[model samples]
Target: MAGSTKTKAKKPTVKKPSANKAAEASHNGAAHAFAPEPGDFRRYFDSGHTHESLGITPETLLDMYRNMLLQRRFEERAAQMYGRQKIAGFLHLYIGQEAVSVGSVWGTRPDDPIITAYRDHGLALARGMSPNAGMAELYGKIDGCSRGKGGSMHFFDVDKSFYGGHGIVGGQIPVGVGMAFAMKYKETGGCCLTYFGDGAINQGAFHEAANLASLYKLPVLLIVENNEYAMGTAVHRASAEPDLYKQAYAYDMKGAIVDGMDLFEVYHAMQELADEAREGKPALVEVRTYRYRGHSMSDPQKYRTKEELEAKKDEDPILRVKKYLLDNELATIEKLDDLDESVKAEVMAAVEFAENSPVPEIETMYEDIYTQSDYPFLV
Candidate 1:
């Protein structure tokens, strides 16, 4: 035994993919063999964007369009309030990624668990959080969803089934997995939509949660809002492979790349995969959207060119929906204008309400942070 003396056996090291397999995978587009394109994907699902897709009612289309508009308007109003110093704190606007939230939320069932990053005002609005309540929260007013405890990045509405406006980049991934685990354990037949940005995808939490979620075949939809730039750092600069969708292959799960600017595409893709997830399979969807606003309100345009930003803005999600509605004769310009006016008025009311709303009393601060009986004793 002494002579055998602690020689650690060399573990077999698997080689990287050979040139042949890499070429084949390249020819095949991805390891999964089903990377959706704009055209093929457009015709594949019946999400009511066109007459060909199934289960698309007129009401659903209208609802989707309306929700997209509402989110866009809400953010625009928030930006104005932020500029006026009415809303304080770091405000991350989801100006262009409206489709990701609107489509994804609409794709899932009402009672399903929804968790997202700090750019969650859109998700909250899409999930039926009142604009007034959401804006009020951004203003740190008591009438806000978190009762004024959470500012822009911490809106939590329990009744609406939205988990939180989580501040940490990849922190919510496990929370979503846990939610899915609950659904699986209870056989609830529901799914949890865990959304984070492209930047967070590189975090260890993302990989670990993805591994566990796939290993257990939990009903979880891990969606990446790959908006090109991770807070001013482009995906190419930050990652070896900017294709965030393919990152799911590490977990042996299917992933899809989608045009995040296209609401119908976002909605249909999410709907398809969410239905699959409910059947006890996990999935990853990377939405290739862009943000028109800076990483936060305080950011200056030092990273990219204005031309680039303007180009991306031309493909805006709200504008796309508006065009689709007009092209299909779903709504007239007057109708759209009226809707805009109504939304603007609603946003105005939110501002007025937030201004009048009281801030949390000093004593109330000690209450929400912890629910334990010994909290007072410790304090």
Candidate 2:
């Protein structure tokens, strides 16, 4: 009995995924996408390139850099606010993945429907949501975008066509498809940008949504913000197809992967996908990004090493744009420093606004509830 033998089953090998117009076959099993593995993402977006080359004006580039700074400073302040217990419930920071949202948004129109996962504050800010309203929402005050009802994970702005800050993993995937369907039906040339983390790729919802979007030729861009980790689990360990965008092949949808650390790469990739999506071609894009903080406030983050984080910091999206601006001579050091100071002041004011804003009134709860015929107290 001790000498009895059993054979192990062979595992299928999947070559890593690549980016751009169409998927390409690899020679010698190499990936077309150069990102987290390369350690030198800046080489592709070399110091020689200018904002004009990227089709953005000098002032617009400055604005993009400023927005990135706003996101970083906002998230930093939000962390402090959470620590003080001024903000309650869960708080997920978007410190390191600003480019994925900002760059993707830059490639699309303001009217395009934007929906994303619970890590939403940065996207909201990038899309022009005021810091005061955003911080107020975190503080659960009446001035919040959701009237303080949605909290951190449910920042919604109908005016901006930003549908939600969805809480459930993979829940927003189907909803995004539906939004795209509506866009197509209305004959609106807008492409719906559906954002989710790497964690949501395997969900049945994503697969089902992708099938429908591809089958009907919906105008939807399924953007997977592959931040290396889905909560605590690394992408490779959790996913059978670790190169997440390749999952699009199942539905015959086009897919591309980008160096999420580089804003130019993200923007250019997203711009191409958006053009296709608006023409009724469903697509998937994996913005390979990273989050510096733990998955959420409660996470201890014992999974990763401090050295790994320090190395990632070298590719910081905010610094990338700042470098481009300075190196291109579009902005001076004093100008950039002043921009930082102004952004700092703006964040501080948002904190003050949240502190002073009043909590939501009880009657409003009865008002938003769909089942209500009349307010219970009023009745």
Structural similarity to truth (TM-score) of each candidate: 0.86, 0.86
Provide the clashing-pair count of each candidate structure. Answer: 2, 0
User: What CA RMSD would you report for each candidate?
Assistant: 9.2, 8.3
Over 63-148, each residue of candidate 1 has an lDDT whose tens digit, in order, gives: 88888888888888889988899888899999888888888888778888899999899999999999888988999888999888
Per-residue alpha-carbon lDDT of model 2 for 1-379, expressed as tens digits?
7998887979989886544424343455433442333321112233243557779888777888899999999999999989999999999999999998888888789989999999999999989999999999999999999999999999999899899899999999999999999889989898999999999999999999999999999999999998999778999899987978778766767877788888877777778778988998878888888999999999888889999999999989988888878777998999999999999999999999999999999888876666655867765
lDDT comparing candidate 2 with the true structure: 0.87
Q: Which stretches of candidate 2 lie above 4 Å from their native place?
A: 1-49, 372-379
Report the Cα lDDT for residue 40, model 1: 22
Alpha-carbon runs more than 4 Å astray in model 1:
1-54, 373-379
Candidate 1, residue 19: Cα displacement in angstroms equals 17
TM for candidate 2 is 0.86
Worst 10 residues of 1 by lDDT: 38-47
Local distance difference test, per candidate? Answer: 0.84, 0.87
